[model samples]
Target: MALAGMLLVAMTAWFVPWALAHTDWGNWWLAIPFVGCNVFVACTALLLAFNNSKRSIPLRVEVARGHEPLVGVIVPTASEPVDMVMATVGSVIDQRWPEDRLRVVVSDDGYSDELQARVATLAAELPHGVVSYFRPPKRGSAERIGESKAGNLNAAIRLLSDANCEFVETRDADDLVADPEFLRLTVSHMMLDDRIGFVQTIKESKTSEGDPFNNNELLFYRGMMLSRNADHCAFPCGSGLVWRRAALREIGHFPVWNLVEDIHSGVLALRLGWRGLYVPIVGAFAQHAPEDVANYFKQRGTWAIDSIRLFAFDRFRHMPWRMRLHFIEQTAFYLLSLPIMVLLIIPMAGLAFGQFPIDAAPMDYAVHFTGFAVAMELTMLAFAADRPLGAFVRTRVFLIGMAPLYAASTIRAFWYGAKKKPIYIVTRKTDEHRVYVSMLKAHWFLIAMIVFVLVMSARRDDFLLDFDPGSIYWAIVGLTGLGAFVRLSWFGVDVKRNILSRLQLRSKPDSHVQSDT
Candidate 1:
C-alpha cells in the first residue's frame, strides 16, 4: 500500500507541473498554493502508508522487585462539574493496583469553596489518605503559580512529594477508567522496559455512533497510533498516560508553558534517549471527541495552533534529524488546511471570472485523479475502518469540511506566536439535537460562496458554455461546500416548534389573549 501511494504521489508531481505549464493563464501565481496543497496531500499519503506497517506488539509481565511501587493517579480539573470529577475519582479507586500503593490526587485550579467541600466529603468516605485534593496558590499569594492544565499538574506533583510515588498516571477530570487492569497492564510494560519513559493507552470516545468527527478520532487511535508506535515515537495523549518519575525529572519537568505539553514532553523524552510505549488496549474512556461542529472546530483549531508552536522551541532544535523531520511532518499536516481551501476555491473563482486556468477537459483530469484518490481511500479504509466504503466516504466529507477551520487556526498560530497566554476551552457534553447559531456563523463565508456560485450558474446563460471545464468544476466544488453546510446546519424539530410558538403569539393581540384566558 505504501509503495502504491508513493507511485501515486510521483504521478501527481509529474502531472501537476506538466498540466500547469500547458495552461495559457497569465496569472502563474495562482498555481503556487495549489502546488503546495498537492504536495501536502502527497505527504499525507506517504505518512498513511508508512503507518500501516506498524502493528501493536504485546508486552510481557515482569516479576516484582520485592514490593509494589507507589503510583499516584493525578486528576486535573478546572471548573468541571463536581459529579464528573467524583466519577473519575471513583474510577481511579476501582483500579486493580494495591490500595496501599495507590494515591489519587484531585488537582482543582478553580479553587471553589463548594468544590473543596465536595472533595472533602468524598475523601472522608474513602480509605484514609487514599484520596487528596490540591489547589494552586491564590493569584496574588507569594506561592502563586502559572495557570493552565500544565500548571495545575505541576502543583499536583508538588502535593504528591510526600507520597514519593515511582510512577504517575495523568487522567483528565471527565475521563473514566474502562478497564480495572489499566494500571496493572501499563505498569507491567514500564517494569519490563526500564528505559520506557511513558506508556500511552488508547483513548476511546464515550460516543461515536453517528459522529464522523468522532469516528475519525477512533481511526487515529486505532491506525495512526499503531504506525507511530512502530517508529518508537508514540507520544502521550492528553489523557490515559502513565509516566516514570525519573524520566520526567531528567527532562526538567513538563513544559508547563507549552500549549501541547503532552507532545512536547514526549518529544523531549525521545530526544533524551528515553523510549515511549503505546498500549493498544482501550485503557480509559474520555470526552476527547467533539459532540458538535462548534466544539470540533474549537478543539482541532487549538491543537493545530499549539502543535505548530512547537517548532519555535529550543529543545526541538537538538533532536535527531529523523525525529526533527517527523515533527515537521506532523506540523505540516495541521497547517495544510488553508492551502487546501485555496486550491479548492481558486478553480471555481477562475470559472466565475472567465479565467479558467486548466486547459484540459474536466473528464480527462477526473480520470487520472479519481484512480489515485480511490487507491488512497482504499488503503485508508483497509487500515482504519472495518465498515463499508460508503461510511469512510461520509467521514471524509466531514474531514474536508474542516479545512477552513484549520486554515484559520494556522493563521492564528503564526499571528499570536507561542508566547501568548494559552486559553483552554473545556469540551462539554453537548446535545447534538440542537442547532448552534455560532457554528453556522463560523462557516458563513463558505455558505455565502456556495450561494453566489449557484446564483451565477442560474442567472447567466453563457456561464456554463464560455467556461466548460471551469463551470463543471465549480458545480462540483459548490455541491461539496453545500454538503458541508447542510451537515453542520442540522436543525432539530425543536427549532421549528419554537418558531411556530413565536408566530402564534405575535398573531394574537395582548387584549385578545387576556380575554381568551
Candidate 2:
C-alpha cells in the first residue's frame, strides 16, 4: 500500500508535466529517469515531515527475570591496529554482564604476528578463557572467496556452536561498546520475539566534542529510516549489532555471496521469516565515521555496488511487501547517481547548444524546475537534524563529487555480475593523509569538458551573445553543480613540501660526509 502510494505520486507528478511539456517522443528515454529521480526526492522531502521517530519506543518483549543467556562476542579484524582491537575487546570485557557469561572471539583474519602475540599476552593479563585469539586457517596466500569478513565470521560463530551460545553479537575491531548495560537491553528486546533475528544498536560516533569527520548517523539511521521502525526493518549498519543464534542458523549463516554482508544478512533474515529491531536510542555503541575521503568512497562504493547487484537480481520483487517498500527507495538512492548525471547533462547540453532538449522555452522549464526543486529543498531543510544550511551544502557537494564513483561502481557491479568476483577490501578506519592525483581522473575529464563547452559557447553569437534567458538559466544550473564538484575534488597543485630530493636532482649545499670519511 505504501509502495502503491509512492508510485502514484511519482506518476502523477511526472506524467502530467511531461504530457503538457514534452517536445519530442525521443526525449522521453532521456528525460524519464532524470525526472523520475526528482519526483522520488520530492517524495522523500515530503515524507520526512511526518517523521515521528524521535519518540522512544518501549520493547514489546523481555527476557524472564534472571534469564541471562551467554552471548558470544565476535570481533572481526582485518589488519586493523592491535591497540584499537585490544581496546574494543577491553570495552566488551567491561560490560556489566557476568565475566563468565561473555566469551570474546577475536577473529584474526589479518594473520599478523604482532596481533596474535598481543592478544595472547592480553588474554593472560585477564581472566582465564575470557578472550581467545582465532587465526582462520588460510587455504591459500591469494585471498579467495570465503577468506573475507563473512568467512571469518562464519568460522568464529561455528567455534562458539559447541559452547551453546543463544546470542551472538558482532563488534568491529574499531568500535567500542559505549554502555555497560547495552547488551541487557538488546538481549531482552529479542527474548520473547522469536521473529526478530537481530537487534541493531544505533551507531554513536560523536561521543567526543571534536568529531571533525562528523560520523554521527542520527539523521540517516534515526530520522531517515524512522518510518521503517514501524515495519521492524532497521537493517544492520556495520558493527555494533546482536544476532540470535537460531536465526543465524536458519539463514544458513551470514550472507557469504555478497560483499555487503551486513545488509545482505538483514534482507535474507527477513526473507526467511525473521525480523530485526533497530535500537534508535543514542549512544548505544561507539563507531566513528570515515576519517578520510578516500576511505569514505571505498565504503560507499562497496555498499552501492552490492545494492545495485541485489536489486538487479530480481530479489526485490520476491521480498515481502512490508520489506519491499524501503528497498525501492534504498536501491533508487544509490541508483540516483546515474540519473543525476543525466539531469545535469540535459541542461548542460542545452547551455552548450542553443537548441534545448524539450519543446518548452528555457525560461518556462527553468521556472517550473526551480519552483519544484526549491520547495523540495526547503522541506528537507525543515526536517534537517543539524545546521540546515551546512548540511544541505555538504549533501549537495557530496552528491556532486560522488557521481563519478557511483557511475563507475554501477558499471563495475554489472561487469562482475556473472564472471569474475569482486574482492571486498575492508575500509580503513584510519585517515589517508596522502593525496593521490589519480583518484581525480574522472573529475579532471568532467572539468575539461565543462571548460570546453563554455569556451565554445562563448564564441557562438546565439549561445550567449543575445542573452537567451533559458540559456542563462541553465548555465547557472550547470555551473552550480560543477562548482560543487570543484569544491569537493579541489586538491591544490602545490607539492613543494612533498617534492622528493631526487626529483630535483640536487643535494643540499651544506650536506657533508665528514663523519663517514
Candidate 3:
C-alpha cells in the first residue's frame, strides 16, 4: 500500500503534469500548488496508513523506584458544567499513583462560583490535601477559538513549579484518565531519559454499536500515533499524556501558538533539544468526541486554522531534518481540503461553459488520480475504521462536508493567527443540543454552486456533451460533495428537531447522575 501510494503520488504530482504540459489544458502555474498540496496531503494519509501506533518500555524497568516523582495533574475548564468538572477531578484522585504523590489542580478559566463551590465540597471528602482548585488571572478569551486553554495551563504550570513537582499532566475538564497505571507507564518513559520531553497515550472512547457521529478515534491512536513514534515525532495529545518538568522549563512552558498549543508546544520542545514518546496504551484516557456535526466542524476548524498558520509562520530550523519532515507532513495534513475548492469548480467550468481544467484524455487522468485516491481511501477505511466500511464512509462524508470551512481556515489563518484571533468557538457538549444555521453557513454557498452548475449544464445539454470525461468525472465528484453537504445539514436539522422536541417534552429539569454511584 505504501509503495502504491508513493507510485501514485509520483505519477500524479510529477509525471502527469509533465506529460500533459504541452496539452491545451496543461496549466503548470496553476497546477503546481494545487497538485503539491494534494501530494502533501497524500503523503500524510500514507503515513497514517503505514506508520506504527505503539511504543513500549522495557518490562524490567522499575516503577516505585524510590524516586517516584510527585506529579501534578492540571485540569483546565472554561465555563463547563460543574458535574463535568468533577468527573475529571475524580479521575485524577482515582489514579493508581500514590495518593500523596499526585496533585490535582483545577484551573477554572470560567471563574464560575458553582464549580468553585462543588470542587471545594469534593475536596473535603477526598484525602487530605489531595485536590486543589484555583482560578487563573482573568485574561480575554479571544485567542485559540473562544478560550485559551494554553493560558490556563501555563498559569497552572507556575503552581506546579512553586511546589517543585517533578512533572505535569494536562487534562481538559472532560478528558478523564482511564488507565489506573497511566501515570506509572508514562512517567517511566520520561524517567528513563532526561531528554525525553513528554509521553503521549492513545485516548480511547467508548461508543455504542451504531455511533451516528463516528466519534471514536481509535484509528488515529493506533495508526498515526505509532507512525509518529517510529519517526521520533511524537506530540502530546493535550489530555492523555505526561510532561517532564525540566523540558517544559527549557521550552518556556506551554506555548500559545497558532490556535492550539499541544502539537506546536511539542514541536517547540523538540526544537529545544527534548524528545517525546508515543505509547500505545489505548486506555490511558477516556474522552468525549464532538457529539454532533456542528461541534465536529468547530473542533476541526480550530485545528485547521492552527496547523496552516505554521506553514505561514513557523520554520523548523533547529529540529533534525527527518523529524522536521515528519512534523511538516502531519501538521500540513489538515490543509488537504484546499483541493476541494478546485473539485467543486473545475468540472462545472468544463460542463457549464467550454473552459476545461485539463486538456488530457479523461482516461489518462482517471487512471493516475483514481488509483491514488483508491489506495489512500482504502487504507483509511480498512485501518482507520478497524475494517468497518460504514464507520469509514460516515467519517469521510462528514470530512467532505467540512470542505468549505477547511478551505476558509487555510486562507484566513494569516489574518486569524497573525493579526487577530479568529472569532471562533471551540467544541462544546452544549453545542450538541442546540441548532444554529450559522454552523453550516459556509456550506450553503458551495451547495448552491453545485446545484447551479447542474442546472446550467442540463439546460445547455453539456451534461453528456462531446464524450467529455473530465466533465463527467467532476460531475460525479461534485455530486458526492453535494450529497455530503446535504447529509451534514440533515444532521444539523435533525439535532435541531431533537433539541426542540426534547425541550417540549421537558416537564422537569436536568439531573446530574453520578457515574461513580
Best by TM-score: 1
lDDT of 3 by residue, 96-194 (tens): 777878778999988999988888898888777668888887776343222478788887777777778888888878877787777887888778888
Task: Report lDDT (Cα) of residue 123, candidate 1.
Answer: 82
Which consecutive 10 residues in model 2 have the weakest lDDT in total? 47-56
Would you estimate the TM-scores of all the predictions?
A: 0.87, 0.82, 0.82
Model 2: lDDT to the true structure: 0.67
How well is each residue in 1-517 modelled by candidate 2, as lDDT tens digits? 2333344345447543753466554666545554565555555544444333233355644445467788999998888888888888888988767777888999898888988888899788777777899987673444433658887888788779998898999888888888667787788888767778988876776333544333564446645555566776777876778999999898887876778588888888877778878775442354445655577678888988888887776465556775676666667667667756665666556556555445665455655555555554455454454444555555655556677788889889888894455888888766555554567677666666666767787788775343444334434554565555554332333346557744555655535556654
The best candidate in terms of lDDT: 1
Cand. 3 Cα-lDDT: 0.68
Off by over 4 Å in 3: 13-15, 25-67, 140-147, 205-209, 283-288, 361-387, 417-419, 423-426, 432-438, 441-448, 451-465, 492-517
**Candidate 3: clashing residue pairs, number:** 3
- Which residue runs of candidate 2 sit more than 4 Å off their true CA positions? 1-16, 25-67, 125-127, 139-145, 206-214, 282-289, 382-389, 418-420, 451-517
lDDT of 1 by residue, 255-331 (tens): 75666478888888998898888887777786545656666667777787778777654437766664565566667
After superposition, which runs of candidate 1 have C-alpha atoms over 4 Å from their true positions? Answer: 23-25, 60-67, 139-145, 212-216, 287-290, 312-315, 360-376, 382-391, 429-434, 441-444, 451-478, 490-493, 511-517
| Deviation of model 2 at 208, angstroms | 11
lDDT for predicted candidate 1 compared with the true structure: 0.69
Report the lDDT of model 2 for residue 71.
Answer: 90
- Candidate 2 lDDT score at position 14: 53
